[model samples]
Target: MIPIRDTAPCHSRPVVTWSLIVVCTVIFIVMQWLPYEVSYRLIHLYGMVPLRYSNPDWALAQGLPFDGYLSFLTNLFLHGNWLHLITNMWFLWIFADNVEDRMGRVRFLIFYILCGLFATYLQWYFDRTLEIPVVGASGALAGVLGAYFFLYPMARVILLPIPFIPFIFNVPAIAFLGIWVIIQLHNATTSVVFKGVSVDVAWWAHLGGFIAGILLYRYFIKPQAEE
Candidate 1:
């Protein structure tokens, strides 16, 4: 389901959200202009590779530079392709503004980074032996969606379900995010059983970020003014 927009309104401009989008877009453009080999090397150097942490000796033996765990944050800004970047930024555009509005800029930024870090580590925990470098903002964006799931549960979301005749329908935020979480769990389970952590999609990262957002948002949420 593609989320077009939501009925929830924001009280202030989402500066942090816009800044994140612009930064990701510019980095992706630079990545596209780079040579294929350079781009590949860049992703490996910055993207989160579980084996880098799980087996430092192996990573060093393979000539992978020690990034000193910074990849946990850097990986959130890297994208594998245009589609991957666009889809993640689009979700952030739709949902992150409201989250930022509720939490304020500083707290929202901290929450986002923490969720992304949690997501990366959780993926590493299960796929420590895998050599693939995970890149993209989906896990962090999933955190935004999870925050929306709690902060605006009753807000109506417009979803376009394709494959069948294209049509739009409004559903509660809780239901939409609930379905998203279920799909992630199913895919994560399938990846573990069949692909054994060698899959392209970081389903566990998404699940971890979503769970982190749900669990941590309350602490970061701003207190409401007394009526």
Candidate 2:
């Protein structure tokens, strides 16, 4: 399943959400100017790694400032490529306005950052010895989707069947998000059984953010009055 846009209307302009997307885009542009080795080193320094938690001092010595606490915030902004940055920012644009509309700007920003941090740790806990850097806004954006599910389960999502396919249709948020969660769970489960590790994507982070969004739904989103 894919999501094109949501049918719900926003009461106010989603300034923070848009601002975040712009900032990420600008940062991506700047990153592109840098040498690949430099960019890789920068991502490695700031991105989350499960091994960092085992010994804070060693992690800090490796350029993880403030004993790795800062990575939780910084990692969300880093992405591997144009596709990574674009897809994440695209989802944020599509789903975040309604969530921000429900929580208000300041609270929504806090909720988003916290969700990203918590999701990063959740991924780390599942694989404590991995050395690969966890970057991108996918996990954080998953939280946005999760929150959207709770606040607007009945809202319609216009989704394109595939990137190349012109066919599009609308589906309830719950069904779309439910399928998303199921796919991630399947990948996570299979990764554990076969590879004994998460190689590419941090599926555990998606699980973490999904659960966090579900748990915090009551506090984070307020439903609009019925028409």
Candidate 3:
């Protein structure tokens, strides 16, 4: 089922969420304008490649920055295509406002970065020698979903069971997120996350980020008065 939006109210402006969407959109637009070869090279350089971290000699031989660790963060802002950018940004727009409101802007951003780093770490752990550039905001957004799963368990999510039959319904946040977890785990067990240029979903990264967000959100969340 596809999620439409959640029935939750935000008390403050989601500045961080809006900014993240704009930055990711702009980056994707610029990448679309660039030549395919250049964009491909950029993905390899900036996207999180597990092999790059696993084999220092291989990384050096390929002229990749063996010591540069920024890819874990940068990879979150990159996308494979318009569909990728849209789907991720849509989910972010839907759930992140409330999360940001709860965590405040600065703490929210930090939590986001940490989740992405942890997400990439999980992907790397599973296949340290895989030679593919894993890029997209799904892993990080999975963290946001994780937060939303706990932060708004009572909230109802509008879901479309079918693509285009004009059918939609409301479901508890816990149920929606629980189904999502199941799907990701099912996929992860069957296949690894990396595909060629298309950059298929990284199930391990999703689970990692989701787990991280659940485990780490308390540290970043503000009290009721603070929020």
Best by lDDT: 1
Tens digit of lDDT per residue, candidate 1, span 7-88? 9999989999999999999999999999999999889989998898888899998778688799999999999888899999
- Each candidate's number of clashing pairs is 0, 0, 0
TM per candidate comes to: 0.94, 0.90, 0.93
Candidate 1 — what's its lDDT? 0.90
| Residue 11 lDDT in candidate 3 | 94
Per-residue CA lDDT of candidate 3, range 72-182, in tens? 889999998889899999999999999999999999999998898899899889768778888888888989989999999989999899998889999999998989888
Residue 78 deviation, candidate 2, in Å?
0.6
lDDT at 68, model 1: 74
> Which runs of model 1 end up more than 4 angstroms from their true locations?
163-166, 195-198, 225-227
How high is the lDDT of residue 170 in model 1? 93
- For candidate 3, which ten residues in a row score worst on lDDT? 191-200
Model 2, span 1-227: residue lDDT tens: 56788899998999999998998888788888999989887877778776777666766777655443677778888888888898899889999999998888887888888788788888888777777788888778888888988889999999998888899999988898889999888887787788655368889888888777777756755435511
Give the clashing residue pairs of candidate 1, or none: none
* Root-mean-square deviation per candidate: 1.9, 2.7, 2.6
